[model samples]
Target: MGTFDAEGVYHPRPVVADDLDEATLEDAVVRSIVDFDDGDIVEGTVVKIDRDEVLLDIGFKSEGVIPARELSIRNDVDPYEVVSLGDRIEALVLQKEDKEGRLVLSKKRAQYERAWGTIEKIKEANGVVKGPVIEVVKGGLIVDIGLRGFLPASLVELRRVRELQPYVGRVIEAKIIELDRNRNNVVLSRRAWLEETQREQRGDFLANLKPGERRRGVVSSVVNFGAFVDLGGMDGLIHVSELSWKHVDHPSSVVQVGDEVEVEVLDVDLEKERISLSLKNTQVDPWQEFANTHHVGELVYGRITKLVPFGAFVQVGDGIEGLVHISEMAVHHVDLPEQVVQPGEELWVKIIDIDLQRRRISLSIKQAAEGGDVSAEYRDAFGEHAYDEQGNYIGYDYSTAEFTPETEAQAAWADYQPEVEGTTTADEGQSAEPSDD
Candidate 1:
């Protein structure tokens, strides 16, 4: 066959039988490629694969060579992963024929066209897709999402990840965040995928959850106000006050991050998606039990837990509270509570009052202040003491062993007029007070 060149020169390649026969052959050739429009995807067999390009036979007279640059949508993917000899492939027709009489084709572009359709439908339906992490670029990662999809770093994981290299070569599932076929832009997010999935699941989980139900969870975070625990698929807030029976400034004082814990669901607000759980609610309340075991006017031993300006807080029973007033330190007045009471000191106190409704107990150290039955010993050692044998001492303890009055009683022998002692004897006693009776 002979064809005219662009320079108006004629070249003879082969000779045919007649003009009609030549026309028939040319018609057949044109008809074979008539449906092969530009951008249309067509299947072919790999004729050869080389470092520079791959040759494919798509029932065309001339084998088409796809350039290495066109083998993959990603810049870093090795061409060897794309094709092998004698393997079937689909490609987009770049042109019928180029200057070299060779068919131009692109496998990546064909896949790209199909990807646009699939990605558009998936994105519209809010569906998920899986792919491998091709590379981690600035602010995001490139995933081979049947196409090069941009996944923001913020959305790469359910939570933010510091290192991104570990994600490479790993397959991941993600939701399509954005998609544009005209501009060939696609954005993906793993976080959104997980959140959407969990949102659906959490609704059902809450539907079955009820108050007073016990469940196990992991401590997600320990904050000052409370600890947030993740109960399998949901999270519950454990207030600091309900964390334990002991006093705590923060939830971390008792529970730690990632600790497995059992909790009772104290409250649940489905509308707000809130669950109030308690770690201490499972235990028996000490104050409730103490009501039956003890009563007012009974002597109970306790330790000083804390002190305030007015009184000292004493721990009566397991979580019970009792106040010892400053005046109760002894029968005498006390200027400060700390003067006689120290924290953690053990003392025997008489229960003066118990407000069960308010969870409070009033104790008096003064009622038991006499050290119970020490009267006889104090009466014999008294040095001008005015105390009755019932353990009442008017003066404070100044001397080492006992309390002595500021004034001494008159000598007993002196009351007998001291035998006149020279001048005042019987004369001073008889006529001194004649007028008054």
Candidate 2:
């Protein structure tokens, strides 16, 4: 060793250049190492590897010792994989001197100091945090984003997740939905994945629908007013009024969840993002069939269903019903419909009037004429007939065979000509063709 004087000239101290005192040098080094303190964050070059500890040289007389546990932040990891000779690593000094007079250093605490701020920034921005699934815990799994994060059993997805083992040893990106640094806990979620996807699907669904389009869907859900159906990817509402031409009490009466159905698109409300569908619109309207099939004076059998103050409703067919008013019930007189027939009673009714556009049909039981007197004019026009209690004609007026008039004047005059002889005329309402007399 050399000493520097005040004038900056060096003076050498006595020393044996040969046969060096190795033992005294070792003793001084040990004494200097014991004087060092722990809990100091320091930098060092990886010097040596002993049986279970890593030796680092930080320019101290004696190198610091980091046992296998203190060597890395992760569990069950080999220190050789993280550091090598000549590799410069920084660590926190844990013990000034251990029982073996070795300085103890830890790599994990050194890493933690650099990690906390980065984690906080990611959480504040509501950004995605990347991590490795390091361990599987009781209610969730642990991840390493240079810090411990807890992902709950729930919130794993938009739907519930049943198995979590497959997540281990895998690295994934998750939204930091919850964070608390004081307790060193972090919670993450994949719900953002599901919501974003459904939003996309909803937009696609709206684009696919339009008015008067015939399409099919499944009954997705039932409410008091209607059923919500899944039309491919979108949802539509089948309102109760549109369910049937008949009567519908509730949607559940005819539809159920998961039931596949065909529906007609009646209207599209883009502003409200709603669709109105009709089940009955997809079928043949019976009132339309009735308009084409029946006429005045035509006889039809119907089952009495509902009674009201004005009339009784008779179901003639699936969706066709006629109302027999109280006045229409008697050629003579009647107080109530029940006075002529009871509900569920099947009877012959004559079509008195029909409004195809309004879907109303006026029927008369009295037109059957079961007991009321038939005028000679009607008897001659319609033939001999029996009347029902409500005045509905029940028997054929056979006078079609006995009457004939030769001319227009003769035909018009036939009714007034007295029932004295044979007659054939259209004013008597004869057929257009006359038979040879």
Candidate 3:
């Protein structure tokens, strides 16, 4: 057969086609079919969606079968949930012909192949990848950024998160910290992204915070050394030393996680982006309170709380302790504080010096023996008759003493007077480190 073209050229068909047999015609049709190999990506339209698999028409002799397992990065998902009939999708050719003589394809693998090329470029350009959290695996989560991207639990937030399940289905942005295509590994850090994005906000927060200024915040976390308080914009650390006016054994003993507290800003390091806060500074200082009510050369009854090599700590007021150096323990030479007084023993002592700045009080048992004006806290307990015109302790009979508030207070003062000498005990001596303000 021949046909005439618009250019007036005559085209004649080959005589070989006119003599072709049915077997030859079938071979020619087979040769015209499109072909693809393993790992080759192909575009197709979803033709059938079964419970176990999806059939995609890629213009091949047989429809490609995408098993439900290969439909998505997620496991155990229904084929209908992944794709609908007549919907166009891309899939990677897994096998030209399986044992069942069907072409096998993987949608997830195709997506992974495409994603890797984009992800590598992003990593090179220092870009961020965002996706929804698909699963919570051990020690981390899996994000579907076209492929399974591993987001570690520790990198999910500025602080390590103990519960990762809540992150599932939540879309988050992250920076690629590590990537290895051969191992099928992609490590991400959402914390890196957060820190980069919040750097400016933190700087502003720190700039506005001034020393000695008080701010209210919620305790975000508690650690052995300190507690971190979230002050709206950023978190600041309250060291254990500044947790209380009195000595604190642990940060938890004073504040717990989620506690609302007023804290004083002690310092701010703009270069380091750190804030130092003090919980005690916002409260009354016990040392300052004791100093206001007491003075030098006054007699105050106290209990020997601890005996150290250099001194003995005497509890004079609530949460207030004064140190009696070994040299001031008595008029006579004393080798150890325990030689002049034993722990838990009660006696009167005179205040020698008070250093509010150093948070220290010096007491002297030897000077107290000379007698002085009793502290106002205990002056009422000692009747005027108990002291001479010179304010020296004279003899008083307890048997004749009437049961009154003064006597009750004196009784509560415990036993022993300033004139009493140290008594021996069989108990072993103990020592303790002096506390600081």
Candidate 4:
């Protein structure tokens, strides 16, 4: 019979001389035994599988024993599930012989050893690694790429995911961000892979998305300052100011996650990979709409929304407000807007001037009290009794009209009041001091 060498090569026994000594024959027989030490990797075939371990025939005098714990990186794995009988495999020598006089091998360590070199090369070349998620660890997922790899939850997708359980058993591709063979650690980022693959698509999308162009997108996330919209290829930011035509308390109030909305592309920063969107732009500008329908000297009803040091903010229309300066609050000298109007008080206000460019609308409660032509919106509410055929106000009870500010420009200016109390007039030259609106 032949004996296996250190390299597992079979060699026939040397022919013995007729006068050979017993000690010389013993030396020759011992030399035929395969030479191996701990840490050496060896090839073998599965000869037996038990609940606790698998036996491998590695051409050694005795079969090598692989404990179930060494079968896979996963904990509490069944040995039978890892390997079947007669399957060829590789294992790392852990012990020449334990207390039971058995050769112990580690399959997982051998796999890790082989995978380390390949993983290092891939990381150096900036290549992607493909693997199946084997376990869900704290803060990340574990992938089986011959060896265990960590994929952080934050780097799993373009956006951070809160749940990680669904990733187990799924094969995925990722970029190697960090590798430490000494520590047996490998960190991967699927987001990096996704971003790298989608770069060209994002560029094309940004190129085609022009300013003022309307787009349909889903709200991916809502932050305190803005909402992020997924515009197919990339995410665009809709600042809180652009979320709606009126003051927004928070971005979430205007848009929630997963809400489909039509938005206007305000700006695109290719260098920064940023997209600025405007939700209010796609819809009609309440200010523009108000300007188109209302004009100077038109009477509208309003509710005193807020009182500022310089004037009062009056809501005249949905999401629209106009400033009633202290000078225009009443015909007489007024120390404060509160002297003429209290919050929640409903009254008539005359549109003094509409500066569409500056987004300011000058309104006057004094002029409204003096009586003027009611706005088109109120003309119907009062019927023909409030106006003559010429569209001029004949007579209407100021206490009963339900007109209100209908311009966002008026609303924007409601918070900004001029320190100097002055009249807002129909003549352009007589316009009040332009406050920062």
Ranked by TM-score, the better of candidates 1 and 3 is 3
Clashing pairs in 1: 1-14, 420-425
**Deviation in Å, model 1, residue 50 alpha carbon:** 2.8
lDDT of 4 by residue, 1-437 (tens): 44555655545457666665546867755764678999999988887788999988787888899999999988899998899766789999999899999999999999989999899999999999999998999999999888888999999998889999999999999999999877878899999999999999888888887888889999998999999999997999999999998889998888889999999999999888899999988878898898888889988887889999999988888887888888887656788776666898777788998898787888997666455677777655554554566676544223446634344423322322233445442222232333321
The TM-score measured for candidate 2 stands at: 0.54
Score candidate 1 by TM-score against the native: 0.69
Q: What lDDT does the true structure give each of the candidates?
A: 0.73, 0.69, 0.82, 0.81
Candidate 2 lDDT over residue span 158-256, tens digit each: 546789899888987777777777777778775664455567777767677778888989998889999988887568999988888888888799889
lDDT by residue (tens digit), candidate 3, 27-145: 86677477779999999878778899988878788789999999999978888888976688999999999999999999999999999999999999989999999899989999999
**Top candidate (TM-score):** 4
- Supply the global lDDT for candidate 2: 0.69
| Model 2 regions more than 4 Å off | 1-176, 183-192, 370-437
Off by over 4 Å in 1: 1-40, 94-102, 156-158, 162-171, 181-183, 284-305, 315-321, 342-346, 353-357, 370-437
TM-score, per-candidate, Cα-based: 0.69, 0.54, 0.73, 0.76
**Which prediction has more favorable lDDT, 1 or 4?**
4
What does the lDDT come to for candidate 1? 0.73
Instruction: Evaluate residue 367 in candidate 3 and report its C-alpha lDDT on the 0 to 100 scale.
Output: 67
Q: What ranking of all candidate models by lDDT puts the best one first?
A: 3, 4, 1, 2
